[model samples]
Structures are given as C-alpha cells and as structure tokens.
Target: MATLPPGPVRLYGPQFEKDPGALYAEIRRQHGPVAPVLLEGEVPAWFVCGYREVHQVTTDSQLFARDTRRWNAWSQVPQDWPLAAYVVHNPSVMFTEGTEHRRRAGAISDALDAVDQFELSTQCERIADQLIDEFAGTGEADLMAQYAERIPLRAAVAMCGMPTADMPGMVRDLGLSIDSSGQESLDAYGRVQQAMARLVADKRVAPGPDVPSRLLQHPSGLTDDEIVLDLLVVMAAAHQPTTYWIGNTIRLMLTDVRFATTLSGGRASVGQALNEVLWQDTPTQNFIGRFATRDTRLGGQRIRTGDLLVLGLAAANNDPHVRKDAGGAVGNRAQMSFGHGEHGCPYPAPELAEVIARTSIEVLLDRLPDLMLAVPAESLTWRPSIWMRGLTSLPVRFTAV
Candidate 1:
C-alpha cells in the first residue's frame, strides 16, 4: 500500500448514502481525476472519476485490462476480504482478453442481436400488465417490490430460455451475488452457474430462440462450458442494471419537476427521463475494474503496473468537464453509463435495455393515470452499496380501476 498515494479517501461508508455526487466532486477536487481510495477492506485502488480519464482507461484495453490475474496486491489481500468475489478471475467473457474475448463477446453480441426488439417489447408489456394486475386492486403498493423489480428479470429469464420456475431462484441468487461478497457471493455465483449449465444442457438437445440456445448454436462454435460461463455474464449484466434502470427512471418521473408533470401523458418524456437518469443516478455506480498492464501516468497520478483502478462510472457521468457543455442530459446520449470502447456494454444490449425500460414506464403510466408518491421524497432511501444504486422501496398509491 505504501507504493500508492497517502491519505486515500475511503470509498465506503454512509456519506455516500446521502449524496454520492457530492462525494465524487470532493474526491475530484482534492485528488484530481484519478484519486487514491480504499475499497471494502481498506484495499487500495485508484478511482477513475474524470470524464476523459474513464474514456482513456476503458478504451486502452491493452494498457488497462480486465484480467484480475495481473493484480499485484493479491498477496496482501486477506482471505476474508468482503470484496474478494467481485474480482475473482473466471474464464468467462468478462475476464477473457484478445482473440478469446472477441470470440466470446462476439457470440454474446450475435445472440443478443438476434432477439427481435419488437417481440421483446411485446413480452415486456405482457409482463408489466401481469405484475400490475397483482397489485392494481390493492390501491396502494411499493412499486419497487411490486412492479419495477419484477418486469426486467422475467424478460431476461424468458429470452434466455430459462424456465419460468427458475425465475425466483435466479433473482435471489443474482441479488446476493451483487449485494454481498465473501462466501455468500461465491455461493450465489455457484448457484447461477449451475442453473446456466442446466440451461445450456437443455439447449444442447433442443436449440431455441433464447440467448442460451442461440449461444449454443452460434457459428462461433462455443463449447458447453464456454456457453455456460458466458451466459452467466450475459444474464448478470442484463438483470441488475436494467432492473434499476426501470426503477430509477420511474422514481425520476414521480419526484422530479421536469418529468412528473407529464404523469398522465408520459410516453413522450419517458425517453428523455431515461437518458437523464443515465447522466445523473446511473444504476451501476462503481465497476470493480481494470488492472494496469504497465506503469502509466493517468489524471496526473503515477499508476503502476498491476495496480487496480475502479471506474467511478456515476462520477464520470457527473464530471463538470463533460456537463458544462452537456446543457443537461435531457436528450444527450454521451454519458458513460454503459461504459465505453471494446469493453463497453456490447452493441444492441443498451438499445434493448431501453426498449424494456421505456415500454415498462409507458405501460404503468397508461394503467394508473393518477399515480402518486405516498411519502415525501426526502424520506425515501437508497440501498447501501457502493457498487450499485437502487431504492429500498418506492411506495406509491393510486385509485383502483
């Protein structure tokens, strides 16, 4: 740790719960774009916060790579580190580099591309209606638990050819994998990997239109093991962020002055609100990140070979350098919410996430024209995790039809 900068700002704790944007601004002011910081276990890392610095790191895959095997601090890390599971190296597309990355990422991209957006939207509508029906008659509901949380995960499972019965288990395990670390994360990952292996086995016998089946039959000729791991990456990437996208966008339309006024006629502004959320309260805040392949200077800090650099994604989106000319992200699409360059959320994935999020809000607005937040916005709280941004619950009320 002595090799890194001194007096590193600890990135964990309650200060982030109130206003993480404020903390990011402070970090940038004191330490510049790339600041010294500590993770869950006082683990030292460089937090990449500047708009251009993030772009520089993510785009230069050769210099800042995803493979955790190159991390030099492994010897100093404790066996019980809470964040250990977040950086575990696996053979999946997430850790693969070079030609192997191209093949695995290509197969995932091709499989996801084959999903007809129109069909995906139609399925989302049905899922939204079904979920709404469950709570509509009650006259009041926690939208986070009742509506926002359900729609995206179901679509993810269905399109991946996973059985409807498996949805409950996948949801439980996936939540643990992101929110918890240590053995809990390891256990949750194991369960999902097993479920994916089963899905791959089924698809091996009978190919279908879902992601798993498509990955199985992809011309790239993926092995069963490869299909299982990559499917894990695909499902994990799609499930959490997309779920929070739907939730956070709904929160914006309900609380913010700009979009709340259009509650009854909401479709026109849904796209704008979605973009605004990406620039403001991005769902995945900190990506546990890249390792330096060789010593380099970034944001005026000396980055050593094998040093860990966490991407402060939400901070990058809020960088004054970028926002000064953005004129507010109402319709601007330049935010790094989906990341950038080769390791960015692959093509069509972000587009498809928009399809799901947009249709979901449109359907809810159409169903409950008089929707209202049940409590003051100040009383609402965010889930406490440095990695992901989401609400504990969004309580709302409306007249039953």
Candidate 2:
C-alpha cells in the first residue's frame, strides 16, 4: 500500500557481516521498528526489530503464521536461492501452526523433558573436561573448535541415543549440512539423513533412555520421517546455539575487563555472565520466520498476505525502548534469546541453556585458570551467516596443568 524504501539494505555482504549491530542501529533510526531487507540471493523480507513489535509478531501466531507454505517468496524466487536453505519448507513443528504445531511441539517437549537435567549437566561437564584435556597439554588451543563446539555436539548426540563411535563422522556431516554453499553440503545432508536413519532403526530394535526413544513413545505417534526431522532439529538446535552461547559468554569474560574482574573476584556468577551475553550477543541473531496470513499493518508498515517476516531477536534485545543500560543487563533474563510464544526453542529451555553454558564455561575456566585470548578481541572473526552470530575461532593460551 505504501512505497517501499528506496534501495532497501542488503542483509548479506562483508560490511553487514563484520558489524551487524551498527547496521541494526542505523535501520532502527531510519526505519523505526520494521525495515525492508534483502536476505541472501536478494530474497526480500521484513525484519522486525522493535521490542514490542517482535513480541507481538511472535505471540500472535494466528495473524503471523509459521507455515512457510504461506510464503509468497517461495513461488516468486528460485528454489536454489541461498536463503532458501533457511526458509525452505520443512515438516517439523517449526513450519507448522495450530493443532499440527501443538502436536509436533508436544512430542519434542516430551522428549526433552525426559532428559535428566542433572545427568545432562554432568555429561556436559564430563565432555567439557575431556575436550579441555585434549588441548590442556598444548598450552594453546582454538576454544571454538576444541571446546565450545565439541561439548554440545557430544552431549546432544548422546541424548539422541547415537553411538559415541559415530560422533566424529556425524559431527563432520552436520557441519557440512549447515554450510551455505556447494555440492558438498548436499552430500553431507544425505550422509546425515542416512546416519540418522540408522540411529532410528537402532533405537527401534533396542530402545534406550534417550530423546529418540522418548519421541518414539510419545502420544503423537510421529512417523519415521517426522522422527528423523525432529531429531535433526534437536541436534542442530542444541549444537549451534549452545556452542555460540558458551563461546560468546567466555569471550565476554576474557575481553571485557569489568566482567573478567567481577567473575574472577567472585563478585559475579557464571549465570550472570551468561545472562548478559544472552541479552547482548544472542546466539541466533534472527529467527522465527512468519508469513503474513493476510494484508496487515505492523509498526506502521504495510504487509501483504504471504509476505515473509523475520524476528530480529538480537536487535529487539538491544532496542533502547526495552534495554536502556547495556552495562547493567546482567541478570536480565527477559531478553528474547530463547525466543517467545509458541514457536520458541523447546529443548534446553532458557534456564537449561544457561546452566549448560555456565557449567561448560566454569569447567573450562577452572581447569585453565590462566586462559586468555591469544589475539586481540577485535582481531577475531565471526562466522558469516544471516541466521546465526558465532565466532569462527577463539584462540586462547592457558597454563598446562
């Protein structure tokens, strides 16, 4: 109904990747709550950044639907568009609504609820210790690759009833499956599917006290295809966000003098440090895509039916309207890092993610008290992805113990 802004900001490219927060601030100043942006491959969508607006969009699933089948872009844009990798239609709860969403989400929640939080924490600590031991003798290691990535993957796979021997190949394939380009990613996805299929078969023959077994016994009676997709969701959800959460919080402690002083001096707990990171550098920067069910207006912007809209969780968390003092964000658990409303992440609930991150980081820090960045904070590079914000590497030197 209104003329779209001229030359809408392109979400991809080096400048945006390097410093997205600056761009988000500019967008807020110029476009208010919502702005038109081009995702990878020039895919256009609405990016909702205002705190209130994001809350509304996420909670009011009736008006703003999660089913991408309602997406107009799917018909207009080529199927191979880079953003398609993220927005592509899937059979999981993430792409469903109404009763279907409840049914699928219920199964996932039940499975996750069966997880022993104490055991999970113990498992994470064990994995963290083993990973730390791998590089403990070296005195220097890339924490991102060595610690942050391994802990979550090991824990997630174990929870899924996957074999420890399959972890290396599965992790490798999962990494490739998330890659943004090339035929290797497609091949990797195939491998992941095959591996997961095997896992499902194994669980069916001899069920265990794991997520897959729980999902199998759920009332929904999810099919094998549905089971595999849901398992992939759990694995990916557990690995990516948890990895970033652990790494970002640790980075904050290592780089920010105030946090380091407070943490080392026992003035602040690991939970406080993690809450600050959740508010500031949220793991998944932008998530929960919803397609407009009909022509609508939000934050003074017009939206046509089937238009794709993404929640800018990171930007909304930083919105001055909701978060005024960035320095005082410690213990601010109100941030939308874990998301809001119905389509939010079910596994590793907000408190659980925080505990896992805190325990993992504490174990590493305790084992390597002298751990510090090997390079300046500014020198570190972030992984380039429109959906996630994560460090590519965190090279740190620590005293061998």
Taking the candidates one at a time, how many backbone clashes does each contain? 0, 0
Candidate 1 minimal-lDDT segment of 10 residues: 1-10
**Residue pairs whose backbone atoms clash in candidate 2:** none
For each candidate, what is the lDDT? 0.87, 0.82
Estimated TM-score per prediction? 0.94, 0.94
TM-score, candidate number 2? 0.94
CA lDDT for candidate 1? 0.87
User: Candidate 1's residue-wise lDDT over 51-80, tens digit each?
Assistant: 899999999999999999999999778888
Report the lDDT tens digits of candidate 2 across residue range 170-250: 988887786535889889888999999889888888999998888888889888789998888777787789899999988
Off by over 4 Å in 1: 1-6, 164-189, 326-328
